[model samples]
Target: MSIFKQIKGFVFDLDGVITDTARLHTKAWHEIADQVGTPWSHELADKLRGIGREESLDIILRAGGKQDAYTDAEKTQLATAKNEHYQRLISTLTPQDILPGIPEFLHDLHEHEYLMSIASASRNAPAVLERLGLTQYFPKIVDPNCLHTGKPNPEIFIKGAAILGLEPRQCIGVEDAAAGVQAIDAAGEISVGIGDKDVLRGATIVFPTTSTLTLANISGRLKEAA
Candidate 1:
Protein backbone atom coordinates (compact mmCIF):
# COMPACT_ATOMS: atom_id res chain seq x y z
CA MET A 1 0.00 0.00 0.00
CA SER A 2 1.13 3.55 -0.65
CA ILE A 3 2.14 5.56 2.39
CA PHE A 4 0.06 8.34 0.91
CA LYS A 5 -2.93 6.10 1.47
CA GLN A 6 -2.30 6.61 5.16
CA ILE A 7 -1.74 10.34 4.74
CA LYS A 8 -4.68 12.67 5.25
CA GLY A 9 -3.12 16.07 4.71
CA PHE A 10 -0.34 17.87 2.87
CA VAL A 11 1.52 20.83 4.36
CA PHE A 12 3.77 22.92 2.12
CA ASP A 13 6.41 25.56 2.66
CA LEU A 14 6.32 28.66 0.49
CA ASP A 15 9.29 30.66 -0.86
CA GLY A 16 11.55 28.01 -2.43
CA VAL A 17 8.94 25.27 -2.53
CA ILE A 18 5.95 26.77 -4.34
CA THR A 19 7.66 29.84 -5.74
CA ASP A 20 11.04 31.30 -6.65
CA THR A 21 10.66 34.22 -4.25
CA ALA A 22 13.65 33.03 -2.22
CA ARG A 23 15.74 35.01 -4.70
CA LEU A 24 13.76 38.13 -3.92
CA HIS A 25 14.25 37.50 -0.20
CA THR A 26 17.98 37.05 -0.72
CA LYS A 27 18.16 40.26 -2.68
CA ALA A 28 16.28 42.15 0.01
CA TRP A 29 18.59 40.81 2.73
CA HIS A 30 21.63 41.69 0.66
CA GLU A 31 20.32 45.20 0.30
CA ILE A 32 19.89 45.38 4.07
CA ALA A 33 23.41 44.10 4.60
CA ASP A 34 24.78 46.72 2.21
CA GLN A 35 22.82 49.48 3.92
CA VAL A 36 24.24 48.44 7.30
CA GLY A 37 27.80 48.13 5.97
CA THR A 38 27.81 44.43 6.84
CA PRO A 39 29.65 41.80 4.84
CA TRP A 40 27.13 39.57 3.10
CA SER A 41 27.25 36.53 0.87
CA HIS A 42 24.98 33.99 -0.75
CA GLU A 43 26.00 31.56 1.98
CA LEU A 44 24.59 33.94 4.57
CA ALA A 45 21.31 34.07 2.66
CA ASP A 46 21.25 30.28 2.56
CA LYS A 47 21.52 30.25 6.35
CA LEU A 48 18.42 32.42 6.57
CA ARG A 49 16.29 29.97 4.59
CA GLY A 50 13.04 28.94 6.32
CA ILE A 51 13.75 31.40 9.16
CA GLY A 52 11.42 34.19 10.25
CA ARG A 53 12.15 37.79 9.12
CA GLU A 54 13.13 38.98 12.57
CA GLU A 55 15.27 35.91 13.25
CA SER A 56 16.95 36.32 9.88
CA LEU A 57 17.67 39.95 10.71
CA ASP A 58 19.18 38.82 14.01
CA ILE A 59 21.41 36.37 12.14
CA ILE A 60 22.52 39.13 9.79
CA LEU A 61 23.12 41.46 12.69
CA ARG A 62 25.23 38.91 14.52
CA ALA A 63 27.23 38.27 11.36
CA GLY A 64 27.81 41.98 10.94
CA GLY A 65 29.01 42.36 14.53
CA LYS A 66 26.00 44.54 15.39
CA GLN A 67 23.70 42.19 17.33
CA ASP A 68 24.58 43.78 20.65
CA ALA A 69 24.58 47.26 19.18
CA TYR A 70 20.89 47.29 18.32
CA THR A 71 18.00 47.56 20.78
CA ASP A 72 14.78 45.55 20.33
CA ALA A 73 13.09 48.53 18.70
CA GLU A 74 16.01 49.08 16.35
CA LYS A 75 16.02 45.42 15.34
CA THR A 76 12.31 45.62 14.65
CA GLN A 77 12.86 48.64 12.45
CA LEU A 78 15.59 46.89 10.46
CA ALA A 79 13.42 43.83 9.94
CA THR A 80 10.56 46.03 8.80
CA ALA A 81 12.82 47.82 6.34
CA LYS A 82 13.92 44.53 4.81
CA ASN A 83 10.29 43.38 4.59
CA GLU A 84 9.36 46.61 2.78
CA HIS A 85 12.07 45.92 0.24
CA TYR A 86 10.80 42.36 -0.18
CA GLN A 87 7.23 43.60 -0.55
CA ARG A 88 8.16 45.99 -3.35
CA LEU A 89 9.93 43.20 -5.26
CA ILE A 90 7.13 40.65 -4.79
CA SER A 91 4.43 43.14 -5.82
CA THR A 92 5.26 42.16 -9.41
CA LEU A 93 4.84 38.43 -8.82
CA THR A 94 2.31 36.41 -10.83
CA PRO A 95 1.40 32.81 -11.53
CA GLN A 96 4.29 32.51 -13.93
CA ASP A 97 6.69 32.92 -11.05
CA ILE A 98 5.61 29.63 -9.43
CA LEU A 99 8.25 26.92 -9.40
CA PRO A 100 8.16 24.14 -12.00
CA GLY A 101 5.42 21.47 -11.64
CA ILE A 102 3.90 23.06 -8.51
CA PRO A 103 0.58 24.11 -10.09
CA GLU A 104 0.07 20.66 -11.56
CA PHE A 105 1.05 18.96 -8.34
CA LEU A 106 -1.29 21.15 -6.31
CA HIS A 107 -4.10 20.53 -8.78
CA ASP A 108 -3.51 16.82 -8.64
CA LEU A 109 -3.58 16.77 -4.85
CA HIS A 110 -6.70 18.91 -4.88
CA GLU A 111 -8.41 16.58 -7.29
CA HIS A 112 -7.44 13.61 -5.14
CA GLU A 113 -9.08 15.25 -2.12
CA TYR A 114 -5.94 15.69 -0.06
CA LEU A 115 -6.31 18.46 2.49
CA MET A 116 -3.64 21.10 1.91
CA SER A 117 -2.14 23.93 3.93
CA ILE A 118 0.79 26.34 3.51
CA ALA A 119 3.13 26.47 6.49
CA SER A 120 5.68 29.17 5.90
CA ALA A 121 7.99 31.31 8.00
CA SER A 122 7.45 34.30 5.74
CA ARG A 123 5.17 37.00 7.14
CA ASN A 124 4.30 37.97 3.54
CA ALA A 125 3.09 34.47 2.65
CA PRO A 126 -0.53 35.56 2.23
CA ALA A 127 0.39 38.44 -0.07
CA VAL A 128 2.64 36.22 -2.16
CA LEU A 129 -0.05 33.57 -2.43
CA GLU A 130 -2.58 36.14 -3.54
CA ARG A 131 -0.14 37.69 -6.00
CA LEU A 132 0.63 34.28 -7.55
CA GLY A 133 -3.08 33.40 -7.71
CA LEU A 134 -2.28 30.31 -5.65
CA THR A 135 -4.39 31.08 -2.61
CA GLN A 136 -7.18 28.86 -3.88
CA TYR A 137 -5.07 25.76 -3.38
CA PHE A 138 -4.66 26.15 0.36
CA PRO A 139 -7.43 26.51 2.91
CA LYS A 140 -5.03 27.27 5.74
CA ILE A 141 -1.93 29.43 5.81
CA VAL A 142 0.37 29.16 8.87
CA ASP A 143 2.75 32.07 8.51
CA PRO A 144 5.14 33.64 10.97
CA ASN A 145 2.60 36.36 11.70
CA CYS A 146 0.37 33.83 13.44
CA LEU A 147 3.05 31.63 14.93
CA HIS A 148 5.21 32.37 17.93
CA THR A 149 8.20 30.49 16.47
CA GLY A 150 9.54 29.56 13.03
CA LYS A 151 10.72 26.46 11.19
CA PRO A 152 13.02 23.92 12.88
CA ASN A 153 10.72 24.55 15.83
CA PRO A 154 7.79 22.55 14.33
CA GLU A 155 5.12 24.94 15.62
CA ILE A 156 4.02 25.91 12.11
CA PHE A 157 3.77 22.34 10.85
CA ILE A 158 2.07 21.22 14.03
CA LYS A 159 -0.50 23.97 13.65
CA GLY A 160 -1.02 23.05 10.02
CA ALA A 161 -1.85 19.44 10.93
CA ALA A 162 -4.14 20.63 13.70
CA ILE A 163 -6.03 22.86 11.30
CA LEU A 164 -6.50 19.93 8.95
CA GLY A 165 -7.78 17.78 11.85
CA LEU A 166 -4.96 15.31 11.41
CA GLU A 167 -2.05 14.03 13.43
CA PRO A 168 1.51 14.80 12.37
CA ARG A 169 2.12 11.24 11.22
CA GLN A 170 -0.95 11.39 9.00
CA CYS A 171 0.33 14.37 7.06
CA ILE A 172 3.17 15.00 4.65
CA GLY A 173 5.24 18.17 4.88
CA VAL A 174 6.83 19.37 1.67
CA GLU A 175 9.70 21.83 1.93
CA ASP A 176 12.75 23.25 0.12
CA ALA A 177 14.90 24.28 3.03
CA ALA A 178 17.00 22.28 5.47
CA ALA A 179 15.36 23.90 8.45
CA GLY A 180 11.92 23.09 7.05
CA VAL A 181 12.85 19.45 6.66
CA GLN A 182 14.12 19.46 10.20
CA ALA A 183 10.83 20.91 11.35
CA ILE A 184 8.89 18.17 9.56
CA ASP A 185 11.04 15.49 11.13
CA ALA A 186 10.72 17.08 14.51
CA ALA A 187 6.98 17.11 14.08
CA GLY A 188 7.03 13.38 13.24
CA GLU A 189 5.62 13.85 9.75
CA ILE A 190 6.77 12.48 6.45
CA SER A 191 9.04 15.03 4.78
CA VAL A 192 9.43 15.62 1.06
CA GLY A 193 12.36 17.85 0.36
CA ILE A 194 12.47 19.81 -2.92
CA GLY A 195 16.07 20.91 -3.02
CA ASP A 196 19.63 19.63 -2.57
CA LYS A 197 19.73 16.22 -0.93
CA ASP A 198 22.89 17.00 1.01
CA VAL A 199 21.36 20.02 2.64
CA LEU A 200 17.97 18.35 3.24
CA ARG A 201 19.54 15.50 5.17
CA GLY A 202 16.64 14.79 7.52
CA ALA A 203 13.86 14.62 4.94
CA THR A 204 12.05 11.30 4.51
CA ILE A 205 12.38 11.76 0.73
CA VAL A 206 14.42 14.19 -1.31
CA PHE A 207 13.83 15.51 -4.83
CA PRO A 208 16.46 17.79 -6.35
CA THR A 209 13.72 20.10 -7.59
CA THR A 210 9.97 20.23 -8.02
CA SER A 211 10.41 19.60 -11.74
CA THR A 212 11.58 16.08 -10.87
CA LEU A 213 8.49 15.36 -8.81
CA THR A 214 4.97 14.34 -9.82
CA LEU A 215 1.95 12.73 -8.27
CA ALA A 216 2.88 9.36 -9.71
CA ASN A 217 6.46 9.60 -8.48
CA ILE A 218 5.34 10.57 -5.00
CA SER A 219 2.75 7.77 -4.84
CA GLY A 220 5.28 5.27 -6.09
CA ARG A 221 7.80 6.29 -3.47
CA LEU A 222 5.18 6.15 -0.77
CA LYS A 223 4.23 2.68 -1.89
CA GLU A 224 7.84 1.60 -1.83
CA ALA A 225 8.41 3.03 1.60
CA ALA A 226 5.26 1.44 2.86
Candidate 2:
Protein backbone atom coordinates (compact mmCIF):
# COMPACT_ATOMS: atom_id res chain seq x y z
CA MET A 1 0.00 0.00 0.00
CA SER A 2 1.15 3.53 -0.69
CA ILE A 3 2.11 5.25 2.57
CA PHE A 4 -0.24 8.01 1.55
CA LYS A 5 -3.16 5.66 1.34
CA GLN A 6 -2.82 4.95 5.04
CA ILE A 7 -3.20 8.62 6.05
CA LYS A 8 -6.11 9.28 8.39
CA GLY A 9 -5.53 12.81 9.71
CA PHE A 10 -3.52 16.03 9.47
CA VAL A 11 -1.30 17.77 12.00
CA PHE A 12 -0.65 21.45 11.29
CA ASP A 13 1.76 24.09 12.53
CA LEU A 14 0.03 27.40 13.10
CA ASP A 15 1.99 30.62 12.50
CA GLY A 16 2.92 30.24 8.87
CA VAL A 17 0.81 27.34 7.70
CA ILE A 18 -2.57 28.70 8.62
CA THR A 19 -2.08 32.47 8.65
CA ASP A 20 0.41 35.31 8.53
CA THR A 21 0.95 35.71 12.26
CA ALA A 22 4.61 35.39 11.38
CA ARG A 23 4.63 39.11 10.63
CA LEU A 24 3.11 39.78 14.02
CA HIS A 25 5.77 37.64 15.63
CA THR A 26 8.46 39.60 13.86
CA LYS A 27 6.91 42.85 14.98
CA ALA A 28 6.79 41.68 18.57
CA TRP A 29 10.36 40.47 18.37
CA HIS A 30 11.43 43.80 16.94
CA GLU A 31 9.94 45.54 19.94
CA ILE A 32 11.89 43.24 22.22
CA ALA A 33 15.09 43.82 20.30
CA ASP A 34 14.72 47.57 20.73
CA GLN A 35 14.05 47.10 24.42
CA VAL A 36 17.18 44.99 24.78
CA GLY A 37 19.36 47.13 22.48
CA THR A 38 19.80 44.26 20.01
CA PRO A 39 20.21 44.44 16.26
CA TRP A 40 17.14 43.10 14.50
CA SER A 41 17.23 42.13 10.86
CA HIS A 42 15.38 39.96 8.37
CA GLU A 43 18.07 37.33 8.84
CA LEU A 44 17.57 37.37 12.59
CA ALA A 45 13.80 37.01 12.25
CA ASP A 46 14.23 34.03 9.94
CA LYS A 47 16.24 32.26 12.63
CA LEU A 48 13.28 32.56 15.00
CA ARG A 49 10.94 30.66 12.72
CA GLY A 50 9.39 27.40 13.99
CA ILE A 51 10.98 27.56 17.43
CA GLY A 52 9.58 28.20 20.87
CA ARG A 53 9.50 31.75 22.26
CA GLU A 54 12.35 31.27 24.72
CA GLU A 55 14.60 29.80 22.04
CA SER A 56 13.73 32.67 19.72
CA LEU A 57 14.56 35.19 22.46
CA ASP A 58 17.87 33.48 23.13
CA ILE A 59 18.84 33.89 19.49
CA ILE A 60 17.85 37.56 19.60
CA LEU A 61 19.87 38.14 22.76
CA ARG A 62 22.83 36.31 21.26
CA ALA A 63 22.62 38.55 18.19
CA GLY A 64 23.08 41.55 20.50
CA GLY A 65 26.08 39.88 22.18
CA LYS A 66 24.03 39.54 25.34
CA GLN A 67 23.49 35.80 25.41
CA ASP A 68 24.76 35.61 28.97
CA ALA A 69 23.42 38.99 30.10
CA TYR A 70 20.23 37.75 31.70
CA THR A 71 19.54 34.97 34.16
CA ASP A 72 16.92 32.32 33.36
CA ALA A 73 14.35 34.13 35.50
CA GLU A 74 14.83 37.37 33.54
CA LYS A 75 14.61 35.54 30.23
CA THR A 76 11.25 34.18 31.34
CA GLN A 77 9.96 37.71 31.89
CA LEU A 78 11.18 38.85 28.49
CA ALA A 79 9.45 35.94 26.79
CA THR A 80 6.28 36.69 28.72
CA ALA A 81 6.35 40.33 27.57
CA LYS A 82 6.84 39.38 23.93
CA ASN A 83 3.96 36.91 24.09
CA GLU A 84 1.67 39.45 25.67
CA HIS A 85 2.42 41.90 22.90
CA TYR A 86 1.93 39.31 20.18
CA GLN A 87 -1.38 38.28 21.70
CA ARG A 88 -2.53 41.87 21.74
CA LEU A 89 -1.65 42.26 18.08
CA ILE A 90 -3.60 39.15 17.15
CA SER A 91 -6.64 40.25 19.13
CA THR A 92 -7.78 42.48 16.28
CA LEU A 93 -7.88 39.63 13.78
CA THR A 94 -11.10 38.64 12.06
CA PRO A 95 -11.88 35.89 9.58
CA GLN A 96 -10.27 38.19 7.03
CA ASP A 97 -6.88 37.53 8.52
CA ILE A 98 -6.89 33.88 7.44
CA LEU A 99 -4.37 33.26 4.70
CA PRO A 100 -5.33 32.86 1.05
CA GLY A 101 -7.10 29.61 0.18
CA ILE A 102 -6.71 28.29 3.72
CA PRO A 103 -10.41 28.75 4.48
CA GLU A 104 -11.40 26.89 1.32
CA PHE A 105 -8.86 24.12 1.76
CA LEU A 106 -9.95 23.63 5.34
CA HIS A 107 -13.52 23.16 4.16
CA ASP A 108 -12.35 20.64 1.59
CA LEU A 109 -10.55 18.66 4.28
CA HIS A 110 -13.64 18.79 6.42
CA GLU A 111 -15.75 17.53 3.54
CA HIS A 112 -13.36 14.63 3.12
CA GLU A 113 -13.80 13.75 6.81
CA TYR A 114 -10.12 14.01 7.61
CA LEU A 115 -9.35 14.52 11.26
CA MET A 116 -7.31 17.66 11.97
CA SER A 117 -5.33 19.03 14.89
CA ILE A 118 -2.61 21.59 15.62
CA ALA A 119 1.00 21.02 16.69
CA SER A 120 2.08 24.64 16.98
CA ALA A 121 4.99 25.75 19.13
CA SER A 122 2.87 28.79 19.95
CA ARG A 123 1.17 28.57 23.31
CA ASN A 124 -1.45 30.93 21.86
CA ALA A 125 -2.75 28.57 19.18
CA PRO A 126 -6.30 28.57 20.52
CA ALA A 127 -6.45 32.36 20.65
CA VAL A 128 -4.99 32.75 17.19
CA LEU A 129 -7.43 30.25 15.68
CA GLU A 130 -10.35 31.84 17.45
CA ARG A 131 -9.35 35.27 16.14
CA LEU A 132 -9.05 33.90 12.61
CA GLY A 133 -12.49 32.36 12.98
CA LEU A 134 -10.95 28.93 12.31
CA THR A 135 -11.60 27.50 15.72
CA GLN A 136 -14.27 25.19 14.30
CA TYR A 137 -11.78 23.46 12.00
CA PHE A 138 -9.36 22.46 14.77
CA PRO A 139 -10.38 21.19 18.16
CA LYS A 140 -7.26 19.39 19.28
CA ILE A 141 -4.12 21.48 19.76
CA VAL A 142 -1.16 19.94 21.49
CA ASP A 143 -0.72 21.88 24.71
CA PRO A 144 2.60 23.67 24.30
CA ASN A 145 2.29 24.36 28.02
CA CYS A 146 2.77 20.67 28.70
CA LEU A 147 5.57 19.91 26.26
CA HIS A 148 9.17 20.02 27.43
CA THR A 149 10.68 20.12 23.94
CA GLY A 150 9.85 22.05 20.77
CA LYS A 151 9.95 21.28 17.06
CA PRO A 152 12.85 19.29 15.58
CA ASN A 153 12.24 17.10 18.63
CA PRO A 154 8.89 15.60 17.41
CA GLU A 155 7.21 15.90 20.79
CA ILE A 156 4.48 18.32 19.64
CA PHE A 157 3.72 16.46 16.43
CA ILE A 158 3.65 13.13 18.23
CA LYS A 159 1.19 14.55 20.72
CA GLY A 160 -0.92 16.04 17.94
CA ALA A 161 -1.15 12.70 16.10
CA ALA A 162 -2.06 10.84 19.29
CA ILE A 163 -4.81 13.35 20.07
CA LEU A 164 -6.37 12.64 16.70
CA GLY A 165 -6.37 8.91 17.39
CA LEU A 166 -3.78 8.18 14.73
CA GLU A 167 -0.20 7.05 14.62
CA PRO A 168 2.41 9.41 13.26
CA ARG A 169 2.68 7.39 10.07
CA GLN A 170 -1.08 7.51 9.65
CA CYS A 171 -1.19 11.29 9.47
CA ILE A 172 0.09 14.01 7.18
CA GLY A 173 1.85 16.91 8.89
CA VAL A 174 1.86 20.32 7.24
CA GLU A 175 4.19 23.21 7.96
CA ASP A 176 5.96 26.20 6.48
CA ALA A 177 9.22 26.01 8.40
CA ALA A 178 12.31 23.78 8.18
CA ALA A 179 12.22 22.84 11.85
CA GLY A 180 8.55 21.91 11.63
CA VAL A 181 9.24 19.69 8.60
CA GLN A 182 12.05 18.05 10.53
CA ALA A 183 9.74 17.39 13.45
CA ILE A 184 7.09 15.82 11.21
CA ASP A 185 9.72 13.68 9.51
CA ALA A 186 11.09 12.65 12.89
CA ALA A 187 7.59 11.68 13.99
CA GLY A 188 7.35 9.36 10.96
CA GLU A 189 4.61 11.39 9.26
CA ILE A 190 4.35 12.42 5.64
CA SER A 191 5.55 16.03 5.68
CA VAL A 192 4.03 18.73 3.48
CA GLY A 193 5.79 22.03 3.25
CA ILE A 194 3.73 25.06 2.13
CA GLY A 195 6.41 27.55 1.20
CA ASP A 196 9.96 28.04 -0.07
CA LYS A 197 11.24 24.59 -0.99
CA ASP A 198 14.80 25.65 -0.22
CA VAL A 199 13.89 26.68 3.28
CA LEU A 200 11.70 23.65 3.81
CA ARG A 201 13.75 21.04 1.97
CA GLY A 202 13.20 18.41 4.64
CA ALA A 203 9.52 17.95 3.69
CA THR A 204 8.31 14.85 1.86
CA ILE A 205 6.47 17.25 -0.50
CA VAL A 206 6.63 20.97 -1.08
CA PHE A 207 4.06 23.43 -2.41
CA PRO A 208 5.14 26.91 -3.41
CA THR A 209 2.49 28.62 -1.31
CA THR A 210 -0.53 28.12 0.94
CA SER A 211 -2.93 28.80 -1.95
CA THR A 212 -1.71 25.59 -3.59
CA LEU A 213 -2.64 23.46 -0.57
CA THR A 214 -5.89 21.92 -1.70
CA LEU A 215 -7.35 18.43 -1.33
CA ALA A 216 -7.05 17.48 -5.02
CA ASN A 217 -3.50 18.75 -5.35
CA ILE A 218 -2.40 17.14 -2.09
CA SER A 219 -4.04 13.84 -3.05
CA GLY A 220 -2.25 13.85 -6.42
CA ARG A 221 1.11 14.54 -4.80
CA LEU A 222 0.54 11.85 -2.20
CA LYS A 223 -0.18 9.32 -4.93
CA GLU A 224 3.11 10.14 -6.58
CA ALA A 225 5.02 9.85 -3.31
CA ALA A 226 3.24 6.62 -2.48
Best by lDDT: 2
Give the Å error, residue 197, model 1.
0.7
Per-model TM-score versus the true fold: 0.96, 0.97
Candidate 2 collision pairs: none
- Stretches off by above 4 angstroms in model 1 are none
- The lDDT of each candidate is 0.88, 0.91
Tell how far residue 115 is off in model 2, in angstroms. Answer: 0.4
Q: Which window of 10 residues has the lowest lDDT sum in candidate 1?
A: 142-151
Question: For candidate 1, lDDT tens digit of each residue in 150-217?
Answer: 77998999998998899999999999999999899999899999978889978888889899777788
Q: Worst ten-residue run, lDDT, model 2? A: 1-10
For model 2 the local lDDT of residue 183 reads 94
Error (Å) of candidate 2 at residue 136 is 1.3
Superposed by TM-score, candidate 1 places the C-alpha of residue 27 at a distance from the truth, in angstroms, of: 0.7
